[model samples]
Target: MTGGSGGHGGGRGGAVAAVDLGATSGRVMIGRLTDGIVSLEAVARFPNGPVPHADGLHWDFRALFEHIVTGLAEAVAREPQLASIGIDSWAVDYGLLRDGELLAEPFHYRDDRTEAGVDLVHALEPFDELYRRNGLQFLPFNTLYQFAVDAPVAEADTALLIPDLVAYLLTGARVAERTNASTTGLVDVAHASWDTALAERIGIPPTLLPDLVSPGTHLGRLTPELTARVGAPLDVVTVGSHDTASAVVAVPMADPATSAYISCGTWGLVGVELEQPLVTDAAREANFTNEGGVDGRVRFLHNVTGLWLLSETLRAWEDEDGAAIDLPALLDAAAGVDGPVPLFDANDPSLSAPGDMPARIAAVLRSAGAQAPVGRPAFVRAIIESIAQAFADAVHTAARLTGRRLETVHIVGGGSLNRPLCQATADRTGLPVLAGPVEATALGNVLVQGRALGWFGDDATLETLRATVAASVTPVGYEPRNGGTSL
Candidate 1:
């Protein structure tokens, strides 16, 4: 089965716009599908980050919305006959609305405000029981805890995930796209619906959440004002609104049965695809998450403190030296040096927030009774090595918890472009690594829109969608060096 012509006058080869928002940056891409081949071109790209204020760190939602509008206009200019638009972003953060007005800027998940709430939630509902109900990894920043820390304003009438809020801003439609909603820690893993009882216990109103809808649901036409502003009439369709969910949908797994993926970006989401949620004591003990995937699959994964470690370290260096470091050169230098470096747990809570990352890393090393790296290159190597080790641990845990034999590790997103990281992951896991489709999140966003518009036929399966992606992009492969697994 394949996508067929359904919307616009572009026949089956129409283009769709994807708004992919990340923690550090965001991009609007135009995905052109010809026959069964998909190609993507970035229309606009912009930096995105938290804004610190008197209270705490929060997203600059207004600026981000303006960027989205600008990107959509750019896409319209490039492809006047765009079929539709889909949006995806990091999960767990959301905007509150009262009488159709945004209440305030959404809090960034990394804000320390949730610390008190985390303890409160665990006290109310034991961690194991909560995990059994939601099957979610115990992330301190999950929406449930965030709400516990500071519940939405009483007047707020609706709560929308980041992507859903963006879509609402574009089309004046309000709906909770399921894939992203699953990350809230307030949804029932078995029923795929909001756990109203749980929400009430957490002091979040059931009325605040909008009706849940699945991926590929046509949200509606873009608002008339937006249409005129963008010079195109595009329907806003829901993809896997969670960026990781969209990335997983675009993972070109050659053999689904024996493949796992690391949607490596600011964070590394490492796990395997499962038909059902893995809600066992083992899974909880490993702190593995079961986020929703496209087509109702479970994204059974672990969130590893990913490139943020290196990125933060670099940021600290740039701030201290008053100059940007040449990343490629530093990586090359790190790769050339061979020696023993201390490995710290990347998931440590102390390293979660933005600050002096290099010093924090050294502190972790010192506390562990290990010598800290003396130079930037050595620090870079240590960070990368620590990330690789974490990835290996997650991969092994996913396999053991799910009883699957892993054969390949697919590293998608920006991290795929890092050769040293890819090679390190392969060496650490003792498994071949396939890395590419750097725009997996956007591709997945567009693919879901394509399918919903009947660009892909009704019979199109996830495999067919991935086949299109596989045929369109070539992946780079890395062979493992060591014979045994590092874990």
Candidate 2:
């Protein structure tokens, strides 16, 4: 199997289905590219969340898989011309397989089991060496730590990252996609392959790892069953399998040299795309990651705790009130508040789990000698302001560390629709902010598949695809105000 080979000049155009799985929800979007313009429509969307099992919080992978297949079927029903399929999702979390069967439900990254493993990993291999080898930040939920805690290799024949697992279910091809592999903390940054040495050091069998494939590699046609079920003989193409990686691919930057992007969703991945990995001691000290990007670029950024702050806080509020809280009303009330809001470290691990976020935030604020917000509105304001501050700090740190001057910050994904967050980030960073195309992950996924199907043309580059996005969608922008108030 291969990509579409016709050039753009040949009037080649088609639709591609993108399965974008986020932490809070999943969507199947169909992207149509014709005459160098792209358009996307959501065919299906379903809520996703952690399930509390006897052991701990675990992902409902079975439910998610069903939703993905449902989305694919809906996509084909909506657009009979759908050409290819691509899947992208949150990184690090994975499913173990034995004899090509998923062994058990995959653990949610927020599960507490990794804490002891984090300590053990550092004891076995110095943090510096891990960073130097993989260029991954020290996330307690990274696959390495998760593997350390779960120790699945003894009974597992294969480990596949979330998106790859979904892809495998569709096409029966078991391979690791590079973009997501970079987040596992088991890939050699320089070589862009599995770090077998590191895996062995951590007691993970090297053979358990799958062969690596770059984005846009054609896996094959969907299995006969899937094809017949979906009513479309679709070929599955590897994309920037990590959701953030796919989002970064569609960041419509006219000039990447002076632009930084915030892939704002459950996590605010704030960073610059660089030609090479920034693995210096400074990068390590700053806790920046060098996740792989399309075309072998590096997404050098900090994983700032993002909208999960607000969403989880709201969830806690609703749980206590036993009713759904209106988010727009809360944001409106938050925006109406006049004075400065208190700030807390959004990256605090205590706030990472799935309960009592608002209370945890209040405790952190009080510990910092800052009064907690008086009500839900104030709390919302605080979370938005804290996220904006984190974004500004990350953008500044990225520029300083990379020796580049940032002229603008682009916020993509669901958070791009967040007017308060966009404006606050601009005001704090003192740079113009561009926000839009809330479906960047899907756009990037489809664009890559489209290019492989030769929708863009043989000479098409990433920039070319981005230009199509720029033409396809209008973005809202915010300029820094108040001479950039201090965080």
Candidate 3:
């Protein structure tokens, strides 16, 4: 990606398409910057989730690819001046390719198949050693753990993480975008490169991993077949390629160093940014991760499961009643509950897998000697409060672990719009919560593409991008009301 206004776009300022994928859903958005105001137009949205296979849960990559291609065509039809496409999704999950042919649809991270992989990986090299090498938190679904049991790795020539796999399909390029690669548990967190020795020691061939590229690197032009389908020749640029990385890129923080962020969606990633990896024993003990970021920064964060709890509870209730629940109204009713509510652990491992979430939560509540809430509204309140409690704990631990006061907290993505959760986090953490830009991941995806096309001019840094995001979208603020806010 160079600073030029030539080729199909032929302008320093033009639109870029961002394909942002999450666990439950995916969307395509068109973004452009004009006079420092970043704007986005959502072009398409498609449902996504675990598809059960004979062996385990997996993604329907073919279906997702069809959606993506159709979405790109829609975007190009709407905006013929589309300069590039950038993709991002949840990390760790991947597709194995042999001679550019997909071996199979990738397994879903929430699948129960990684149990033996954890044991096998730990047996070869214990977790603490792995932590010092990768600076990643102990997630059972990290790519290395998944690779331990994946038979496809033995036959595949390359393994691409979700977004990279999508890019490969669109542009026929094979390369790992660094930000997402950092979460795979095979990268040298300090050097920002793959630890091939560790990878081979753990059964993954280094050849299966492609050369890494930084965000904003030009991948390639869309394939001729894709070009004909989309009605234009567009380049593919590497954005963060990890949904959380993209979300953090668009966190319109007043000051990142003194502020903690909760990239709240499927997981509430809580932490502050650093210029260097923090791989200390204390950080490892706290299960804090130092993932790579755009412009070579460190995203020192902890993952606490987020919206999945409430979403699954709602799903179970809807299945039982065969009717959709009104979430806003339920949250409003929940806010009216007067006294303290029963709280359960949001980070409990048993609550991880998909199914009967309400029952699992109730079991955890009883295990903690707290009775389940009486009704639906109370149950929802308990869930939000419990999540808020987790957020507060992570934020406090982050502050202590990093030796930062962390005066302000910024909550971006879907959970930011949850007023009750935001208020509870503020009240619990004693820090004012700034929330908005619900489409931060897509926005960040666009911002990177925009900059790559010289839309922001030369010398534009991450701060410059943050300034643009703040100007484009304002955030809602929540202050602590009760005495519990004291740090």
TM per prediction:
0.97, 0.97, 0.98
lDDT string, candidate 3, 1-487, tens digits? 3322224343456789999999999999999877668899989999999999999999998999899999999999999878899999999999999988999999999888798899999999999999989999999999898999988789999999999999999998899999999999999998999999999899889999999999988888999999999889898999989998999999998888789999999899998899999999999999999999999999999999899999999999999999999999999999998899988889999999999999999999999999999999999999999999999999999989888878889999999999999999999898899998899999999988887777766667999889999999999999988653423
Residue 377 error, candidate 1, Å: 1.1
lDDT (tens digit, per residue) of candidate 1 on 405-487: 88999999999988889999999899999998899999999888888777765577788889999999999999998864422
Candidate 3 or 2, higher lDDT: 3
> In candidate 2, what are the lDDT values of residues 1-487, reduced to their tens digit?
3434444224467888999999999999998887678888988999998999998889999999988888899999899978789999999999999999999999999999989889988898999999999998889989999899896658999999999998889999999999999999999999898899999998899988999998888888889999988988898999999999899989999999999999999999999999999899999999999999998999999999999998888888888999998888888888888899999999987888878888899899988999898877888999999999999899999999999978888999999988988999998898889998788999999888887877766887889879889998889988888664222
The global Cα lDDT (0 to 1) of model 3 is: 0.91
Best of the candidates, lDDT: 3
Q: Which 10 successive residues of model 3 have the least lDDT summed?
A: 1-10
Return the TM-score for candidate 1, rounded to 2 decimals: 0.97
Q: How accurate is candidate 1 locally (lDDT)?
A: 0.89
CA-RMSD of model 1: 2.3
Candidate 3 all-Cα RMSD: 1.7
- Counting only residues 3 or more apart in sequence or on different chains, how many pairs clash (N, Cα, C under 3 Å) in candidate 2? 2
Better of 2 and 3 by TM-score: 3
Ten contiguous residues minimizing lDDT sum, candidate 1: 1-10
TM-score of 2: 0.97
